[model samples]
Target: MSSISDHPLRYKLANELHARPFPSMKAPCSAAYVAIKQPEDAVSRDRAQDLAHLTALLDRHGAPHPQPGATHYYGQIGKYWLKWEQHTEFVTYTAFSDGVVARPFDPAEFDVFPSDWLENAPGQRMTSILLNIVPRPAEDVAVTGSLDEWFVSESLAASEVLDGAAIMAGDFRIDLNGHLRFAVFAGAQTGARRIGRIVQRLCEIETYKTMSMLGFARVRALQPGLNELDTKLTGLMGTMSDERASAEETLHDLLSISAELETLSARSSFRFGATGAYEALVDQRIAALREERFQGRQQFGEFMMRRYAPAMRTVHSAEARLEAMSSRSIRASNLLRTRVDVERSAQNQTLLESMDKRSDLQLRLQRTVEGLSVVAISYYAVSLVGYLLYPLTQATGMSKGMLTALATVPVVLLVWWLVRRLRKSVE
Candidate 1:
C-alpha cells in the first residue's frame, strides 16, 4: 500500500505562516516607515507599479530584486534593511538602520529613502513615521525630559509595556518633517526580537489609526448631503397619507430617494468595512503591548479612548443612519404603492357596478320591445284567420263576427307560446 500524498498547496500554504516575519533589531536603532496608497480606487491599483518602485529602490544599492509578483520582501539595502509589504489597499516600506544618530528623532533619519525615490513613489503617502529606539534611562527625569523636548505634552502618550520590558511614547501628531514620531525605550533585558516586535507594533498602531480616520473624514463630508436627504424623505413621508398629494407622485419620489440611499450604501460599503478592520487592528496592536501607566502619564489605549473612539463612533452612527433611512424609504414606497393599487381597485369596482346597472336597464327595454311585437303580430294573425274562416261561415251558416272572436283567442295563445320558445332558444 502507498502512503497518502500531500495536497498541492500544502507547502505553499504552510510557508505563508512564516512570511513577513517580525524584524530582529536591538536598541539604539531607528526605522523609517511609510505607507503609500492611491488617492482613489486603491484596492484595484496595479501591483506591478508597486513592485517596480520597490525594484527601483533595490537597484540603487545593487540588491537582488524580489521574486516576480511577490507580495512581501525583506533584504539589506546599503546601510539599512528594507521590509516591503503589499496589502489590499496600500503598500508599506519600513527601513531599519543601526546607524549612529546625533540627536533624538532626527529628521535626517528619514533620509534613508532618496528624495527622488520618494517623489516617484507609486502612490501618495498615507502616513510616514520615524521611529527611534534606545535603552531606557536609569533616571525618571531623563525619560520625561526627552518626551517633553520632543513631543507635545497635551497629546503625548507614554506607557510601560510588556511588564516593563520597554516604555513607548508618541504624541500621534505630524511633525515639521511631515512624519509622525514615536520613541521606544527598551529595558536591558529586552532581546533584539522583542525590541523589533515593539517597534513593529507601534508602526501598526499608527498606520491603522490613520487609515481608520479616513472613514471619519468621509462621514464629515457626507453629513450635509445626508441631512438634506433626510429632510426630503421626512417631507415626502408626511405627504404619504395626505389627500392632496397624488399617491403615484409620492411613490415615485420615495423610489428615487430609496435608489439614492442604495447608491450611497454601495459606495460607502468598502470604506466602512475597511475602517472597522483597521480600527480593530489598531486596538489589537495596542493591546498586544499590555500597556501600564508611566509617570502618571496617559497610556496609548487611554489616549485612543479619549481622542479616537469618538470618530469611529461617528462612522458607525452614520452607517446606521444611512441604513435606517434606506429602510424607511423602502417602507414608505411600499405603502404608497399599495394605496395606489387599492384606489385603482376601487375605481374598477365602481365601473363594474355602473356596467351592471346599464345591462339591467337594457335587458328590461329588450323585453318590453319583445312584448309589443308579440301583441302586434297577434292582431294581424286574427284578421287573417277571420278572412279564411268567412268562407267557412258561408258553408256552415255561421256569422263572421263569431269566427273572428273564436280565432282571436287561439291566435293570441299560439303567439305567446311561440314567443316564450324563441326567447328560451336565444338565451
Candidate 2:
C-alpha cells in the first residue's frame, strides 16, 4: 500500500479506475469479456453504432428517448426494459420484461422474422437468453396480431439459437418453453446481474496495475537514500587519494577515513533493507486484495452458473432447497410459539388450584370460630338458668348453690361434646 503512494504510475492508475461509475455512456462496456475479446476494436465506435440503430428503430415507432453515452439500452415497450450490450465475442442482448417474460419468438409467423440474424456462428450453441434477443411490442396487438406472422417455428428452434435479433423487426412472442425457466421473465435483472460480474473483472485489472506501480516506486524511492550513503563513502575515498607528506598524521587520517567508509557501507545496506521491506509490504497488500477478488469471482461464477445453465436443472434445484429450508424454519417457529402458549396456560391453571386451596382453608377456619362462639354463648345461658332454679330448689328443701353449680357444669360439658360431634359430621 505504501509503495502504491511512493510510485507515481501506480497511484495514477488506481485513481483512474476508482474515479467513476458509468464514466462515458457512449463508451464500450468495461467488462473484461468484451474488452479482452477485441482489444484492437474501438470501444466507443462499435457501441455507438449499435445504439444508433436501436435508437433509430425505436424513434421510428415513437418510443422513449435514449440517453447519451448509455453503455446499455433499456426501453419500456411491454412493461420491460430491453437490454443490449457490446461484449467481447459478440453483442449480448437480453430482455428484462415482466417477472415471467418470454423469449422473443412467434410460433404462427415465419417470413416477417429473419432466421440468419439469430443463428449461431458454426459449432457453438446458444445456451442462455443472453445470446438471444427479447422483443417488447408497443401494444398488445403488435404481439398477438401482425407480429405472429414472423419466423417459422421450425427455423429458430431448429437453428443453433446463437446471436440473433428478434425475428420480428421489434415484436416478439412469449416462449412457451420458457415457462419452466424463470429467466424467461423479461427485465434488466438478468443483464444487470451479468454486467455486475464484468465490472468486478475490471477492478482486478486495476488492482494488478496498482501492484506493478508499487514495485517500481519502492526501488525509485530508495535511490536518494543510497545516494546519500555514497556521498559519505566518496569523501573517505577522496582523503585516501590525497598525497600529504606526514607519517603519524597521515596514518591516523587513513584509519579514521577507513572507519567512516565502513559506517557508510553499513548505512547503504540498511537503505537496501528498507526498500526490500517496503516491497514485501506492497506484495502482502496485493495478496490480500487478490484474495478478496477471488471471493468475488467465486460469487460471480455461481451467479452465471445459476443464470445461464440449463434453465430447469440448476436454478430449480437451488429454488427448491431455498424454499424447503424457509418452510422448515417457519414451521419450527410456529411450534415454539404453540409450546410457549401451552406452558402459560398450564401455569395459570396451577395458580388457580393454589388459590382454591387457600379459599377452602379460610372457609374451614370461619366455621370452627362460629362453633366456638355458639358453645361459649350456650354455657353462659345455661349458667343463668341454673342460677334461677337454685333459688326455687332451696324453697323445696334442697342444697340450692351446690345443685345449681353441678347442673351448670354438666350442661357446659354436653355443649362442648355436641360441638365436637357436629364438626366431625361436617368433615
Candidate 3:
C-alpha cells in the first residue's frame, strides 16, 4: 500500500508531515501543505495546487471542514488549518498540536478500532487511513523532530531532527538567525516513469551579500594576514641592503689595510736585519697580517660578488626593463655609479704605467749622451798630442804634414774602435 501510494494529495501530506516537529501532533484525518512564498514564484504556484488538492479531498471525505474566512478545514475525519506569511508558511492540525502539546502519539491512532467500537465506525484499514494522513508532498521536506516522551518542546524548534520516507531527499537548512531556522529545498517527483524528470530545481541564489557580510566582519577585525605579509617582505629587503652595505664597507677597509701593510713591508724587513730570530718574528707578523687581511677581504669580496652585486644587478635590470616603474631614478643612479667606478680605476692604472715608462726612457737617453761626450773630448786631446810629437819624428826624415796626418789617422781609428765598443756595450 505504501509502495503504490503516489497521489498528489498524499505527496503533499507526506512533505508537510515530514516537516512537522511532532508526528504525534499529526491529525488523524486531516493534513495541510503551506508554501510561504511571494507572488509570481514557482513555489507559490506549487503551494496553491497543494492547497486545492487537500481542500478537494477534505470536501469529498467527511473531514473537519474549513471555518468561514480562514484556510481551516473541519470535518468528521480531522481538522486542519494553513496560513501563509511573507515568504513563510505554517500548517497546523488539532492532532498535531495535541501530540506536540502532550507527548508522542498513541499507537492506537494508527491501529484499527475494537470490534465493540465498530458498530457505528466505518469498515476501513487503520494503517491505510493513517498512511493516507501521512501526506507525501511533491516537495522535498525535512522534519525538525519527532515529539517523544523525552523530547522538550523548546528543543523541537532548536533541534534539526527529521523523519518521513525520503523526507530530506533535497532539503537544507536556512540559518536565518541564532538557532531559529527554517528548512529550504526544491520539489520532488514520483516513481519509475518519472525517472528522467528532475525531482528538484536548482536555485542560483545571489550569495554575494552573505559573503560580503563575512568579508566586512573580517575587515573590521583588521586581521594581520595581509598587513603582516607586506611588513615581512619589506623587513627582508631592508635586511638584505644592510648586509650588503656592511660587507662592501668591510671589504673596502680590508683592501686599504692590505695596501698599508704592503707599503710598510720594506721597513719592517729592514728592522729585522740578518738575525734569524728577528727575521722569523717579522715573518710571523707579516704572515698573520696577510692572513687576516686575506680572509677579511676575501670573505667580504666574495659575499658582495656572489650575492650583493648580482642582487643589485638584477634589481636594476628589472627596473630598466619595466615599461613604467615607481622607483626608476634610484636604480639608474646605482647602475651609473657602478660603470663610472670601473672606468676610473682603469684610467688610474694606465696613467701610473705611462709615467713609469717615461722616466725609464729618459734615464737611458741621458746615459747614452754622456758616453758620446766622453769620446768626442778624448779624440780632441789625442789630436793635440800627436801634433806636438810630429816635430820629434822630424829627425826620422818624415814630412811634418804627412807625419801629422798619419798620427791623426791612428788617433781617429783608435777613437772610432773605442766608440764602437762602447756603443755595443751600451746597446
Quick one: best lDDT, which candidate?
1
- List ranges where model 3 is wrong by over 4 Å: 1-375, 384-388, 423-427
Which structure is stronger by TM-score: 1 or 3? 1
lDDT, candidate 3, 1-427, per-residue tens: 3567567688767765444221222211222221222232233334344354445545444455443333443334342322221112222222211222121223343222222332322221111111112223343222322212212332221111112112211112222211111112112322321211111110101111121122233333332432443354344335434524543443343344334334333322322222223223333322321222211123212322453344334433432322122122234334434544665788888998998899899878976875676568666956786678777775878777676766766776676677768877987
TM-score of each: 0.89, 0.26, 0.19
Error of 1 at 32 (Å): 0.3
Candidate 3: lDDT of 43? 38
lDDT for model 2 comes to 0.38
| Residue-level lDDT tens digits of model 1 in 313-396 | 999999999999999999888889999999999999999999999999999998999899889999999998888899899787
Candidate-wise lDDT, in order: 0.92, 0.38, 0.33
Q: lDDT for model 3, please.
A: 0.33
Which ranking of candidates, highest lDDT first?
Answer: 1, 2, 3
Off by over 4 Å in 1: 41-43, 368-427
